[model samples]
Target chain A: MPVQLFGPVQVSDTVEIPERSGTAFTLEQGDTLIVIDPRGEQVADLLAFNAEDVAEIISSGRTFDYAETIYLTTGHELYSNRSRPMLGIIEDTVGRHDFLLTPCSYDTFHHFYPKLQPHRGCFGNLAAALEPYGIAPDMVPTAFNCFMNVPVDGATGKLRVLPPISKAGDHIAFRAHMDLIIGLTACSAPDSNGGTFKPIHYRIERG
Target chain B: MPVQLFGPVQVSDTVEIPERSGTAFTLEQGDTLIVIDPRGEQVADLLAFNAEDVAEIISSGRTFDYAETIYLTTGHELYSNRSRPMLGIIEDTVGRHDFLLTPCSYDTFHHFYPKLQPHRGCFGNLAAALEPYGIAPDMVPTAFNCFMNVPVDGATGKLRVLPPISKAGDHIAFRAHMDLIIGLTACSAPDSNGGTFKPIHYRIERG
Candidate 1:
């Protein structure tokens, strides 16, 4: 479960995401989503959703149009909500950035990290981000995970969290289509797979 | 219940706090004890652990020096667990921003908001911002409300939430002395009186 990089992105861009974007690689306008894998040794858990097309985000081997060559830079728009762009790409370090595949919150953390009881995560962030925009928690959609190494049996496509290749501070940015809102939770579960936590940093900027 | 705007602050620009700072504002270095009244019209719903020392942040406010002021154009490091700073002002939007508030949760909204259903808000995004920093729910410290316009009883000097003046997109930002972890729930508190919430942008930058 891995994905290659190719894009038009910049640093300090805004990002917006649909409530139901599956854990996959996707984009929108006026939104900045950064997967800062400290030292480029982690994976970013990403997701995407479109109005007509459910969630079409590519989890591993994300297509960045190698032919396009230009990474998402200031003003690149991500689309959603029925093909409307959700966020814009305003910054990037080119292919050097890795979309590590990481998602937070599972029952395992409850079993292992009991001291850290009631650990909440991103699934809830979406609800909070959407409130101002009129999006309610009932509208929260399933997400497409990006940078995640969800290995399917090759015969069966299944989601799985693998070791990351993203480093610290390596992030992504984008904008919103119709004021997309999202939530954030710094991974407290050391390893989400059964319950482990790896320190990560999520930063944002308005380019 | 309100303060006027002053001049642009730079790295080490000292400011003085009148008695208003004594009852309204606060500052800390070792722990994450902060709040904000985004409405800018309500008094900050602040509850302090070291409540007895309300006058200290005021004294510190007297000659509150702006040690550094970099336009968070891009890649501006505000504050983090690494190389912590004691006091940092939010040099956002010409150095005028709100960094003292909490996202009231749905429960709070229901309890405070009259007849209104729970709504979406900033709390989720605030939580998301903490994940990468390795701070978790357990790390969240008791927060103090800030920037709100609270009414002091004529003789008792008690604080109460009043109507707000904050416009859409008006925000508050701050730099933490310690690695701070925050949770958000866009305060739709029926009882929490403040201005209406319009969409706004939240950012973190490094100098």
Candidate 2:
């Protein structure tokens, strides 16, 4: 199981990704971004890209492939497209995560609530967050789902969605390897975290 | 088995996603993106996001969940995270496709070639293609793998990667349900397409 190590620190910046919205910020190399599931059930779409080039970003597939493990917690390094270390998990309060699933998007809600057109989702939230940086919504890529619950049936690989194991104030921290543009989205999926959507809080700490 | 249906049409756009690289293009609601494995062994990372909202992108988990199948081919509607139809598979010359696995990334290759250090992967390719639009590499989500073979051991759900069954010129086509920014990456994994990497050709056609 994953355990938290970094609990107290001097924070440089703290902000909340409003329910169903997204946030973007910058973190210098060696800095750490702490993603907090304030309510214990909400999921956060955690994404990062090289400050100079967006093409070299963190890849969940590679993270799992290199780790040779399905679950991630402290000590795991999130790798970029070029295999460069992007972030290292220095602390994690919740060991269970859903790197296997993509963040919920408008189309995901439409699958169940077609009549509720333009439903909010993590995909939209991230796009909105990146817009100020001149990134078009269509160019936004997939995300690394943090705090999401997706349990795989070890016997069959069948996935079962569940509520997050985090508690209020539970957080995870990553030490950046390069200057990064961090994008985050507060997941709004009704099925996430026990059929309710919640907000997320985060902070960046630099030495 | 999935079968091809649409054929012999004027190409609106024809381009090659070179081996170890990625390509990004646009397709209107009625337009179709035809991915061609020129040498019949290359795997393509197929991804798409709403032209209006990048967050409304494709999700392999939802696609398989809604389709109720692990394999994808003709007749399957590539659903977005919201469960709305994004692309409809009108044709598939090669019936076997992988939706259960995430796209290859730097970490994925490092597992086998730690010394290779900077092994190229589909994740980086896609991130590059979206660079012009300001979408960072970390934002490139999981992908729909086309043509690469991944045989599932039924009882165990153990995935065994294999060479593509498609011959040269084998292809797949998807009719967009909405305006879309489609991304494609020619997988460069050493084990892809029978131990050799190849290029992929694609074209968009409008009714």
Candidate 3:
């Protein structure tokens, strides 16, 4: 599917992360990264690091602490491990997102099937995407689970993976606070829309 | 690190899923599936289906209901969607394993880094592993997250990813109650043992 570009912003960089794959690019300060849930049923795992120091990467704990909410929506700022603002959700078509859920990995699939090996998980995808930038897998930290529906069971405090409540072409855009290296993984969890993981479309625009 | 094979169980099959990869296999009734966490840090996502009917596959929700606990240990029988016993854990070197979490996917990685395409996720791994048996991606379902440490906060009900408490060479073995097709994805999350995703060792034996 073609990548969709949002209006009014001067487009500088545009990339499309196909189903079960990843892409990497640099986002300058004030640049806007637009992530599209093309099919509206897919969830996108987002990870990022400051161009100056990777150690000060995205931290879900900090983001949640700063936002004072378990879920993220428009006007919320994503914080790095250093409690620094990295990206701000200036626009959000879908109101629900998961800041509480960690990224999925091979361990996740291996739980259901013992014979299989660790395949492409978000960790691997992020590692591969950041390899060129000298980023290590261990440096890849927590994420903002965009469009992922993880409702917390009030009684037992359990997390349920439900289908996205977003519509086709719905998206969330983040404004970069600094020069950043960003990665994207189209979630491949079966719970992600019952295994028919649709692709995600994204574009970076000059603000 | 080297791959370790357990005692004289007469291994009939052996497979290794490299970091960010997956494997698939089958076992007859009474056979055994051994999953080894060579580094004791990686998690394995497990998925299975009755050989006679793929629709009757392992279900995390059902397994949790039957096990009556979120963590998996020896003697816990994994249940299918129909709440039928599938794999019975005969032995466990590590007492703690998580069944509360779901597998990792591309959408997961893409959420943080926008440029990344979907790379390896358990769903892709399971599909690739089950392809020989004609299992499609959409058919790949939720998993039993083995060796994963997802501790939930009691007050806020948030999930936290932590390093596994398992030691090197730790393993978990399950005995098949019926003919079954299984898939596995090695846990590849950075939060999984600080990102040095060591390889996993596995073998099937005649019981």
Q: Which scores better on DockQ, 1 or 2? A: 2
lDDT of each model, Cα atoms only?
0.32, 0.75, 0.72
Locate the minimum summed-lDDT window of 10 residues in model 2 chain A.
A1-10
Per-residue lDDT of model 2, residues A47-139, tens digit only: 787888876766655564466555677898887756678999899998777665656676667765576655657777777787776666544
DockQ score of each predicted structure, in the order shown: 0.01, 0.19, 0.04
TM-score of chain A of 3: 0.90
Task: Grade the docking of candidate 2.
Answer: incorrect
- TM-score ranking, high to low: 2, 3, 1
lDDT of 3 by residue, B88-191 (tens): 99999887776644455554445533564556566567777899887766555546767877666544545566788777788899999999998988865566
Best by lDDT: 2
Off by over 4 Å in 3: A1-8, A113-118, B1-207
Model 3: fraction of the reference interface contacts it also forms: 0.03
**DockQ pick, better of 2 and 3:** 2
**Residue range A69-181, candidate 3, lDDT tens digits:** 56678888987755579999999998877765445556555654356555656657777889998886645544677888766653444456789888899999999999999
Residue-level lDDT tens digits of model 1 in B26-76: 233332222233334332222221223211111110111111221121123
